[model samples]
Target: MRVLVAEDEQDLADLVATGLRRHAMAVDVVYDGTAASERLAVHDYDVLVLDRDLPGVHGDQICQDLVGVGARTRILMLTAAASVPERVAGLGLGADDYLPKPFDYSELVARVQALGRRSQAPVPPTLRRHGIVMDTQRLQVTRDGRFLRLSLKEYAVLEVLMRADGAVVSAERLLESAWDEHTDPFTTVVRVIISRLRAKLGDPPCVHTVPGAGYVL
Candidate 1:
């Protein structure tokens, strides 16, 4: 899943972004509404964690604008206001979900994950292909019943390919879904990760490069 976190509180924003990344979600953070708008315009994010009182261009407007344009990005608005009316207002502005501040971290993660799922075509939590089995809920992967140890990035890339169900997936698509904005477009990061993944998945080499096209599993 790819996520954008728009929060004016630097510490809170960084914390949320880092935690989401640990869950194998590609995340980008902006400290203000203006920067958030800029990033939103450029990236096709699956979810947006927006603070309702964002500086520069209130989060309400951002949510409304995105909904107005029919963007598929799911919005989860956050605020310190715990009142019922406040949440109603946020949702009325087009937020898909709303969470009050001082919320439990686990709940926030669950909400984001749930929203991410809504943003994309439905897929089973457990993916099976080419003798490889991925239990997304447990963050576990096994090939022919042999459990595989993979880094977060490796797991994310593998998920994207497995979800493709034998269709070719380009390097650019992998980067977009598995990496944040900070990654260089020309970097060999995807290839390096793919190499590591192939080694871990072992023999029979199901992952294949299609030369000028992309990769397939």
Candidate 2:
């Protein structure tokens, strides 16, 4: 999933971004609300982990703007204020969920994952195709019951393809879904990752290229 974390606390933002990346999410971090707004305008994020007390542009205004446009991105508002009224107010501003500061990292991850599922088409926690089984909840993958150890990027790319359900997925689409904004648009990383995935998946290849079209599984 792709996420935007808007937090004024630079340290906390970095930590959250790193943690989310470990979960195979493409995350972009912004320490101020202005940058957050810019990224939000440019990227098609699945979830927005927004801080209420952001600088440059208050998070409340950001939430209001997104709501005004009926954006599809799910928002999880964060704040140091833990009162019931505070949460209610945050949710009232159109956030899909509210999470207080200093919250459990696991809970944050779970909430993000839940919101991501809501943002996209309904997909089961587990996906299976062509003898390949992917358990997203456990972050596990296996081919014909044989466990496959893959890098996070490899797993993320594969997840996009598996979710396609045998339909063609263009390389640009794959890059957009699996990579953050920092990735070079001209990079061959997608092709490299696909080659690596094929090698790891082994025999009776599942991922196939469609000449100029893209790739299919």
Candidate 3:
């Protein structure tokens, strides 16, 4: 999933971005609401982790604006306010979920994943094709019953290709969805990741390259 994290606390935002990246999500962080608005206008994110009290524009306005624009991105308000009124206010502003600050990281992840699911068009929990199986909820992938050990990037690239269901997925699209904003668009990073992913998936050579076009599985 691609996510936008709008939090003024740089350290906390960085930490959350790192944790989400470890789980193979494409994350972008902005320190203030204006930057958040800029990124939101540019990228089609699946989820937005917003801090209610933001400097430039205030997270409440961001949430309300997102709703006004009819964006499919699910909003999860993350703030230090734990009062009932605060939670109600956040939700009333169009947040899909709310989590008080000092929250458990695992719970945050679960909530983000849930919101991500809600944002996307529904697909099966486990995706299977050509003897390969991907259990998204369990983060497990197996081919003909043999488990595959894949790094986070490898797993992410494979997931994107497999989800394509044999349709061509361009390298640009892959980069946009699997990597963060820091990735160089001109780099061969997507090629390298796909090469490694294929090697790990092994034998059958399901993944294929279509020169001048894209890749298919």
Candidate 4:
């Protein structure tokens, strides 16, 4: 999963990113709300960890803008203000969850996971197809009861395809959903990952390339 973290505190941002990365989640950290808004507009992230006070734009405004634009990324607002009214305001502005400053890192991680689970597009928590089973919570993929070793990007690609099931997912859609903003779509990165996945999946070819279209599983 990918998460975008926007915080004015350099140390806190790095700390949060590092902790999430340890759990195999890809993270992008930005120091201001303007950059946060820009990143949100271009990339697809499972969750947005936003600080309420930020440079250029307030986090609440950014969250509101994202919701107004119909962005589905779940928002977890962080602020020093711990009042009930403050939390309510954040939620009213489209944040899915709110955490005050000096909170526990474990709580933050749990909240992020909960928001991601809630934001998913009505798919079951665990997805299974073509003898392949994916456990989103465990971040594990298994085929025919055997584990499959995959790189982070490869796992991300397979997760996207599996979530879509038999639907034909376009290249642009996969790029937007699976890759960060820095990844170049023109490059054969997705193709390479798909090739590796196909080799690992073996005989039945769980992922099928549709000429002039995209891929389906």
lDDT of each: 0.93, 0.94, 0.91, 0.85
What would you estimate as the lDDT of candidate 1?
A: 0.93
- List CA RMSD, all candidates: 0.9, 0.9, 1.3, 2.1
Give a tens-digit lDDT track for model 1, residues 65-178.
Answer: 999999999999978976999988888888999999999999999999999989988998889998999998878999999999999999999999998888899999999999
Ranking by lDDT: 2, 1, 3, 4
Encode model 3's per-residue lDDT on 123-207: one tens digit a residue. 7889998899998877889999999998888888888887888889999889877888989999999889888878877888988
Instruction: Give candidate 2's TM-score.
Output: 0.98
What TM-score does model 4 achieve against the real structure?
0.89
lDDT score for candidate 3 against the true structure: 0.91
In candidate 1, position 18 carries an lDDT of 96
TM-score of 1: 0.98
Q: Number of clashes in model 4?
A: 0
Q: Where's the lowest-lDDT run of ten residues in candidate 3?
A: 116-125
